[model samples]
Target: MILDDFLIYNTNGLYCKCGDFYLDPQVPVTHAVISHAHADHAVASNNEVYCTEATAAFMQLRYAKNAAKVFNIAAYHQSFVVGGVAVTFISAGHMLGSAQVLMEYQGTKYLYTGDYKIQPDATCEPIEWAKADVLITESTFADPEVLHPDPVVEIKKLNDISLNIMLGAYSLGKSQRLINLITEHAPQKTILVHHRIMPINQVYERMGYKPGKYQIYGRKLMKQQGGFVYIVPPFTFDSYARAKDVKRLFASGWKNLQVNKQDTLFISDHADWNDILEAVKQVQPSQIWTLHGDGRHLKNHFNNDIFVKLLS
Candidate 1:
């Protein structure tokens, strides 16, 4: 469907095209409005980007020299005119500076929710529901059976398994959530983080979020503690031969599938089935378009008015 003069296409990533305006340039969109700095959600090829300041900094660090015009929009509800369309951003609560985009054109309002979670997290602002004529959302954990343990309870259990257990997750969003959870519940425990995640951790700290005491991974740090919680990117396990002695736990919605326990965990940054239903009820959008992960399964349980589309 066309909104204003923009053409909307569901690209492989969390990207949408409106005429020459694209929200994310994972592929190729003239104008991109990024929801966050996740690698999959934001690509450097896009010429123009509209996102929160945190996301812009992240993109710049990773995709240096990319001639992308980035416009910083605060996490609060604020509107900007892009290509004659009014666009606004609201908190998504998935990570620091994550936002949900609201686009209005020709009196029609459309809300696009990037990866989001309704549960209140201390590390980030809570997700805010906004009224929209068409709402696009993520259904990462759409199945009712795919419920996640409470953040507090799960972190404790994870800590109990092994004080030195290394959690495997995306270095950006999931890692921050795990850090905050550990700090709030297991503040006494020393948290070790990978070198790649250290930079982002600093940003989180600057935002006034207490991330607990953490050290960068190295021989000296590793030898100092035998039972400390460590957070690392999922790719770390690819070279598990070096980490054979360390117990590794994977965390993501992909863990819900009956896969190898060593491969994934049920901890996800996105809202699960219960959270999705609650969000839909709270937002009460006229129509729903699901994106990311297993959206079809989640849409089956909802009314026909809710439209389900997979992220191509």
Candidate 2:
């Protein structure tokens, strides 16, 4: 079956015609099936939002009164009907509440994988696979050369440095993951988190996972010692680019974002090339649809074996 006939990309996002809803709509939508709470994937203006309980909590934390008018929360592997089509939420292993939306219509299952990771992380749920006829996956790091190194090895690099470190990471998922990694790997360095990241961390704590011990950020704390790992959001980290007395490092898989005098920390929450291939093998889809990044790699790699369609 041609999945594109029912699932397609519009200016808003991937719209499911059969389900009468949008998957992670880019803008305000009437019926939004959110895959996660990332700013890019989940918005506040949706009229009806369907997602996991954790995602709903994160959205409420981030959006407050402006959040969706109605929330249809579902748990992992739970199935529900939307506009006559069966829909299920599967763990994507991207963050606290990330999910892969599985829509079934006329006996054909289409899986839309949000940003996901296969690497084991104690902070969030591990990736779970579901069989589907069509697999819609993200190609953020689909190139064969883009293999992410072990995050424990990457975080251990902090122990080798004696100076105060200004680490940049996304506040929602990456920040919490870094805290866990640092505490587990670099026991010598103390963790300090920016004020903006505190609420998200609290959400993680409420969900029953300890993201490691960390104190709130203070200028005095960073200036007082050389053994502190001060974690801040990207803007704050970039602002201190000219400041002295600390080493600047950004924890990410993208080489472009790892610009600093110090060595890069190739830590990512998204699936890399090998992980994506593994997901493809697990899903065993008749057709592959790619989005969120370049799909040429997957399309080229699958050449004649399976149909690879680029949605973006």
Candidate 3:
């Protein structure tokens, strides 16, 4: 097992004792190296934060009351040293400004893949890989047989159906990705999204990752364009009075989603088992640490040859 104590001092999030910083810490700290804008990974009330430019902007939008006291912007592949530890950010392909953090100290290199996907996405940066002595990865979809279906197939489901569709998705990364997918694959359908998703979309556009055509959610627009596709945040979907003719569908890859046959669009933004394996092959890490989901599948799959540790 050979765990390097100095590189990872796991208390709150993945803390780096050498750097005196936390990677995506849940509890606020003096210095936090954030991975992305997702609510869970990017938290509020930190003395100083280091993340990609888009992630910093997203933090301000998401946590207005207690945003990061200081935003240290780091572009992709940008390397900087913190307390003698070399650090760099790699495109994580999870969402806008999502990144894989690389840290090197005392001749040992480590990479923490914070919620990533290899499958090409239209709305954000593409995934990039590099070798590391140790790799900390997410096991969101760790089951070997749980390979995700092509997202385009899910978008086509809406195109194939004739009824007005009310698609429920998370407002941040998933919404923007879905809009671009639908527009690029099913261009014939008019797409309308919730008010919450508009500003994030604008951020993506400013970063030059513009999504396809979509208007903010409006009852008048839906009435004018009879069968327009309405995309709303999962929580707010019910608040909007459902039109009699509209079919409701929730987009996610979770198996529980299938319980209700009526409304489950199997689309996801996180990496599946196959993507995880590919990342492992690319990084070729001496040791692998998993988190964020049931990591049994990944640990079992690579049991014989590779060192797989479950970091609860």
Candidate 4:
């Protein structure tokens, strides 16, 4: 690797010593390279941030306009030299403007897959494949037992429910994806979003991603009768637990511990076990470093076949 020992995880997050920058640092850093606008990946207190245009917009929405001291927005596939390392942002298809950080130095390419998905969605860019010497990937759904059912099937199930449904999701990426799914599969039902998701959804639409029709959630809507769909962040659902006609459906790869009786919608914005395996075969990286989640399944499954290690 051209960066050699510089590209390593430290107390904060992925730091590039030579470049004097961090990739998705957990805490505030002098220079941070954000992969997406997700809360866990993109924080508000950075001195400087480098990310895709849409990510910057989402960051502004999430953290307000003054989230960082300096924000540098890059177009997809555009390369910018950062402290002698050539860097490019490729679409990750995880969320609006989510990107895989590609760094090349001394002719060696390292690709960091920051929460990507191969599944196509109308609201964001599709995943793009590239060759790299090393692949730093997320294993959020790497277990063999985890197979994401076809989205059409899952969305169909959501459409079939008779009661007024309370669909819970992350306010950023997941909720927007669900809104699109609900639009395509269940056009007849009314779609309402929490105030938390409303601003981000507007940002997505302003970024030219049209996820069809949806309205903002209101207390008055909760009193409505019949089979309407209310999509909100998980906590928003908790605020309305006593609604009589509401049937809860939590949308995520994992189950919600707090809402035990609620149904799981099995909607994942990350790659599942099969998708991760497919990524391995396609990327053809010489060495694999697994981070995020347990990081065990990919390491165990590909150890004998390829060079693999759990970084986290």
Q: Distance (Å) between predicted and true CA of 235, model 1?
A: 2.4
Between prediction 1 and prediction 2, which has the larger lDDT?
A: 2
Per-residue lDDT of model 2, residues 1-312, tens digit only: 555678877888778888889999989999999999999999897999999999999999999988899999999988999898899999999998899999999889999999999998888998899999999999999999999999988898898888899999999999999999999899888899999999999999999978998999888888886889999999998897897888889999889888774588999999899999999999999999999899999999999999998888
- C-alpha RMSD of each candidate structure in angstroms: 3.2, 1.0, 2.0, 1.8
Task: Give one digit per residue, the lDDT tens place, for model 1 in 22-42.
Answer: 665558456778888888788
lDDT of 3 by residue, 1-312 (tens): 334564454557777887889989988899899999898999899999999999998999889869888989999999988777889999999998999999887778899999998878988889999899888998888887888998887778777777778888888999888888888888888999888889888888888988889998777776653458888886777565454667777788886644247546888888898888899899999888887888888777878788888776
Deviation (Å) of 251 in candidate 1: 2.3
Candidate structures ordered by lDDT, highest first: 2, 3, 4, 1
* Cα lDDT tens digits for candidate 4, 1-312: 434464788998889876788999999999999999888999888999999989898888777866898999999889998888889999999998999999888888888899999888888999998888888889887789988877767787766678888887888888888888989998888898888788888888888897778998777876777568988787877787786777877777775432545455777889998898888788899888888877777777776877776777
Q: What is the lDDT of residue 30 in candidate 2?
A: 95
Against the reference, the lDDT scores of all candidates come to 0.71, 0.91, 0.84, 0.84
Ranking by TM-score: 2, 4, 3, 1
Quick one: best lDDT, which candidate? 2
Kindly give the stretch of ten consecutive residues in candidate 4 with the minimal lDDT sum.
255-264
What TM-score goes with each of the models?
0.86, 0.98, 0.94, 0.94
List the candidate 1 regions with Cα displacement exceeding 4 Å.
Answer: 1-7, 10-19, 72-75, 256-265, 304-312
Better of 1 and 3 by lDDT: 3
